[model samples]
Target: MDDTQTMHAMGIDDAYHVEQVLARGPRGVTELVTIDGVGPFVRKKIPTVLAQRGVWSALGGSTCPRLPRVEATYELPDCVAVVLDYIPGLTLEQAVAERGRLQQNEAVSLAQQICEAVQELHRLGILHRDLTPANIIVADDGAHIIDLGIARPFTNTANRNRDTTALGTYGFASPEQYGFAPTDVRSDIFSLGRILGFMLTGIYPDDASYATLLADDPNITPRLRAVVERASAFEPSARYQSVQQFAQALTAPSDPVDPVVPAPVSMLGASNGGIRTRAIIIAAIAGIVIVALVAAMTLIPRWVANGDAEGTAANGTSQNAGPQPNTSPDDNDDDMVPSPDSSTQDSEDDDATRGDAAYDNPLELVETGWSADESGLVHYAFGLRNTSDSVCIQFPSVEITGRSEDGSVLFSHTQALMVAFPGETTYFGSQAGNSNGTVPATVDFTILEPEDYNYVNSGESASFKVDNLNAAPDGYGGEIFSGDIFVTKDSERVREQSSQLNVSLVLRDDAGAIIYGYTTFVDWPPEGGSRPFSMDVFDPPAYDSFEVYAQPW
Candidate 1:
């Protein structure tokens, strides 16, 4: 296909002056072009049959530094032209071929940058279905991501289907990219792992001459190899759930249980002697909780009947109590309980809240931060890790205060926390409306030992399964979703109340901040079956991703 003829047919010659022909072949025309005032961009004239290049318009003026901003896109009779800001750098493929293999630290550095760029793509609801060394440009700052020719919008579904075309570079592509399953963030992570390996070895993982991990690979670091192995796990669930997580694993310090063994910076550090240590600690915690819970259960009935217990949880108080407030808000946790990973280390791989004021305190504030919506309703979401060996902070309340530059309080309120079991972590979230559309300069958290908030050290059942989730834009431009919920297991409860299901949703923006929160209810399904649920969030804000939580009230 001649580039001049294609431009002439579309009348693009009138608006875009073709300065140079960059490449023209079966892949169609890609050229450097200039406009009346603006100049120098790579315009890709892709045939409609190849891709609906009009989708590139969404990337115009991309805020991500690693992405070549799409300046404009045009739809022609038989082709769509995408004009992107020209990035001046060698593609990683060219660099590797010209200069040989990259250093280990250099490879890790570039991988981190690529990870960040992919994270931005994910935030934009786009998946770079094909992330290869040839598509990444090695610039001064780091790597720049290009060629969204095979990108697709992110759609999370438990019943995911295969990619129709299965398009990707053989060596760098994830198995799912070859139609094994729908590619998501993990697919990009997989390619990243392959790129790291390629950069160090000068050969793809699929190459016939590829080096055996240990035998021929002496240049790769111990911990980095472990990171790559997990990042390139055959199972998507086994890989890092998000790029942020992958980066953490890459940068976190490694410890060897024994000098001869390499430690994996995993969610539970499940490697070498660490897994055994983790398992033993977990077992000890579980056994202690079970014994204490059994004792509490046996005595509760008799105590209630004989009036030997506190009159009501509302009148109870913690020994760490402050001046009791005359009245306290009802425990909002009854509305939504966060069931994060069972591991106390946190699924986010957050451990900063430990080892300082952590072990000494029963309830350690794992992480605290705040975000706001377009309307400026400040929302605070924080994680609380219960370090206690035999206690569950039932309805633990916290005083949240937003402050300004001078430390003047802007808004103050209390939110009840959920049940963080012994050595387990729970989360709390709350929102406050601001009159002037101004967010807080900073947010602070304070534990409140209110007289009324429930504090139970007893055990209860906590089993739930929410899957096959699907989201769609309501014709009116709002977001709606549906999914299935199952009561995988039941817990023993007191005779005073019946178990009820409460479903909570946390819609997050690209930065992983909560933009919206909503709660709903669903009926229990028949024994061994699941119940379907549909929910609509009113005044729903725009979000790229979301997390769901289900629990009993």
Candidate 2:
């Protein structure tokens, strides 16, 4: 393996017949090199002492299955070159970005695997000081931990609380790595939690775009969200003590346990103990009530059968004429009749309650604008607001009809937005198609409800105002429009629900004739914050003017 093969087949210092350059760093270079017997392998050159120690420990000692295998290492004049097994797969970061947010179950399973690997490393007295998403690779076999460049021995001694260097990625790194505390197992646990957040939100922990953590992300479940929040707590003492513990809690059953109900006395055994005593007491009380009722029944009829002191019967008739008795309470019905005023008031209250329960058209089109690029494509963007306090409506589909100057239909396009939310103003942008004329004369917008759309019951209401709206044309015949949605929080508590925003934009001619119509959208906006939005249209050169509208159904 040490024999000189070629000088320059692929480039830099052709000593090892390099197939391709994988990566290059300030201190070292990674390349795909071939051997006579071994088909292909990834070779990394470590020009620094710290990295060399990591490669040496991995090659000679670490037994963690998740860690990459170091096949061989050779000392260079000023560096050490290590040959490693090249696992074929995208990095975990790449996987998350490509797949968007992973399902909760999938993220949990993946986190468990990572925990197992890191736990093994800690058991072997190694601390992977830099454990970021880029250091993990997802392949057919399983997730593999890579890039142990900063790994070092972790001693449990009291004096191990201090370190000379502050090393690790922001957001993923623990406070200890910020020179605030000691770097230890707990530090890795913090990074793992951040990684879990990334997998569940498709957003890195430190990115400004993910300012709220998982607050607005609908893909994450509340149970998982709580787990992440606790694990990523700023204080190390507040986090899970170890990787194993964190994994256990992550995979633990989240649903609350149901309380046990007491068995009925009838189902108890005939032991003649407490059960027998309770039964006898209940029977005695029932017997006394029965005797009293019987005594009253025996006396009531006799009293009624006899005439009163005035010689009047119980039926309010003269006893001398006839001993008439009332047979039922309905004999005097006038006192039971309802008053007109009270009845009318009750009816009005019912009508008001029904009206409150009814669903209103909560979708509102705030505004619309257009832009065009040099390529002749026209872009349209619009704003929409959800007016209903409780209902979180989503637009499953939409239809737009473009008409000519004479009001005759020219073209139409149907699009699925899959957008939803309540109270926040959502911005939607889309490109219009090439037009036969400058623009369609008039346009119509239609919104379709999603299959699983349901209105939720909420006590609070949300309101938003669109401002700072502007539009411009791009060089590619596309338009760019931007605006800020200022949301004011409701005075009452708001119920959290998920929904998407769907929108339609129409270009109209001066004659009020149909011109062009299209659909577009942006997903749910934050609950109560100012969100700036921009839209681009690609299909170009249509109507003289445009109108924008939004709807959630």
Span of ten consecutive residues with least summed lDDT in model 2? 292-301
Estimate every model's Cα lDDT from 0 to 1.
Answer: 0.55, 0.51
Estimated TM-score for each candidate: 0.43, 0.43
Each prediction's number of clashing residue pairs: 0, 37
lDDT for each residue of candidate 1 in 1-553, tens digit (9 for 90 to 100): 4776665657764588889986543235678988886878889887566664434655663588888788766666666778898888999988998987788778888888988888888787778866788789998778999777667776664543434333465456665553224578888888787788788777666554554742345777777777777777765676777788777777777622212232332212222211233332232222111111111111111100111132211111101111222122332222223223222432232321111111122555655544443333454455555555544444455566667678887766555432455656554333443423455566666765422113233444356678989887533224457798877665434111222344556665555544444444454555678877755433344455766666532
Residue-level lDDT for 431 in candidate 1: 46
- Candidate 2 has a TM-score of 0.43
Model 2 lDDT at residue 192: 90
